[model samples]
Target: MKFNATLLAQFFHFILLLIFLRIVAYKPVANMLKSRQEFITNNVAAAEEDRKQAEALRQQYLADMQKAREEAQAIIQQATKAGEVQAQEIIEAAKTEANRVKDNALQEIAREKEKAVAELRDQVASLSVLVAGKIINQTITPEIQHGLVQDFIKEAGDLPC
Candidate 1:
């Protein structure tokens, strides 16, 4: 092949154009691409960290809800137990009061019965004294004695004497 000056000059021009383009466009574009890649990597890492934090918060919230439920259940159980105890105490107090009232009523009935018996005895004694006075004032006959005894029985059986 012959040494062509025109071919050599074209090759030199092509080399100079490549050098200029590399300095002006290629390096800047490569650096921009590298910076963009770094930015994307940093953003992806930050997004992953945020996702992890959100997951942790969700777990904590679930745990807190469970704990709250447990506490509420415990409080309800405690209240139920207290109510049962109070109900039992009320029943016991009512029973005690009823028993006391029953005893008091029985005692009152006994006292009334005793008072009635004493009043009956007093009436009997007064009627016996009155009969004795009539017998002393009258002639003693079988029919008169029987009639007086019957009259005494009638007065004793009737009330408001």
Candidate 2:
């Protein structure tokens, strides 16, 4: 084998170029890659934290909505109960009013019946007096009749006031 000066010089120059590239370009590129990886990892962690917070907020919102629904249902129930009570009270009042009206009608009818009976008794008494006067005119003497008239007047005057 023959050794050449040019080939030896070229080999030395290639090794020196490799050392310069490793110191200047490769090291700086590796550092830049490491910094970019760290930045990406921090961004992913922040996104995960945001997701967890969002999930917690969603659960809280759902709980609040459920509580509100329960409250609304309770209010509706209370309103229904109150309405029923008021309706019952109104029905009771109407029944009471009806009973009172019936009682008043019965009382008025009784009063009217008593008035009719009194009028009928008065008519009967007047008829009896007329018959008795006809009998006295046919049979009694004038002196007897005058004495009876005076006696009837005295008896009527002496009755209770």
Candidate 3:
């Protein structure tokens, strides 16, 4: 085949067009693609950091809840112990009051018994005096009167206190 000058001229033109496209359009498109890739990577890293921070916060909240529960338990125990102590104290106070009342009642009963006995003795003495007066009113000798008085005195002395 005979070489054509027209063919050679078209080939050179095609090569020049390719070099021009590489210098102008290809470089700018590549730079834009690189910038886009960097932006995507940076966003992914930031999201990962935020997720880690959220996890830490969740763990902290759980720990705080546990501490609060423990504190509530301790408070309940203390209140129970205090209630028991107060109950015991109330029981002791009641027992002491009951004993004191019992002692007072016994003492009052003894005093009442003594007072009744004294009253009975006075009554008996008065009756004896009345009987002696009646006897003396009737005619009797002085020696007989003295003897009767002595016997009455001895009997009165023998009465229970």
Per-model root-mean-square deviation over C-alphas: 3.7, 9.4, 7.6
lDDT sort, best first? 1, 3, 2
Which residue window of length 10 is worst by lDDT in model 2?
Answer: 152-161
Q: lDDT of all the models against the reference? A: 0.95, 0.85, 0.88
Which regions in candidate 2 have their CA more than 4 angstroms from the true location? Answer: 1-18, 134-161
- Model 3, residue 100: displacement in angstroms? 2.1
TM-score of each: 0.79, 0.68, 0.61
Selected candidate, larger lDDT, 2 vs 3: 3
The residue-by-residue lDDT of candidate 1 on 22-115, one tens digit each, is: 9899999999999999999999999999999999999999999999999999999999999999999999999999999999999999999999
Over the stretch 1-161, how does candidate 2's per-residue lDDT look in tens digits?
89999999999999999999999898999999999999999999999999999999999999999999999999999999999999999999999999999999999999998887777667557655864786567778897768667765665555433
Off by over 4 Å in 1: 1-16, 136-140
The residue ranges of model 3 lying beyond 4 angstroms of the native Cα positions read 1-21, 124-161
Give per-residue CA lDDT, model 3, range 1-161, as digits (tens).
99999999999999999899899988998999999999999999989999999989999999999999999999999999999999999999999999999999999999998997987679688868876786878777798778778877776677666
| Rank by TM-score (best first) | 1, 2, 3
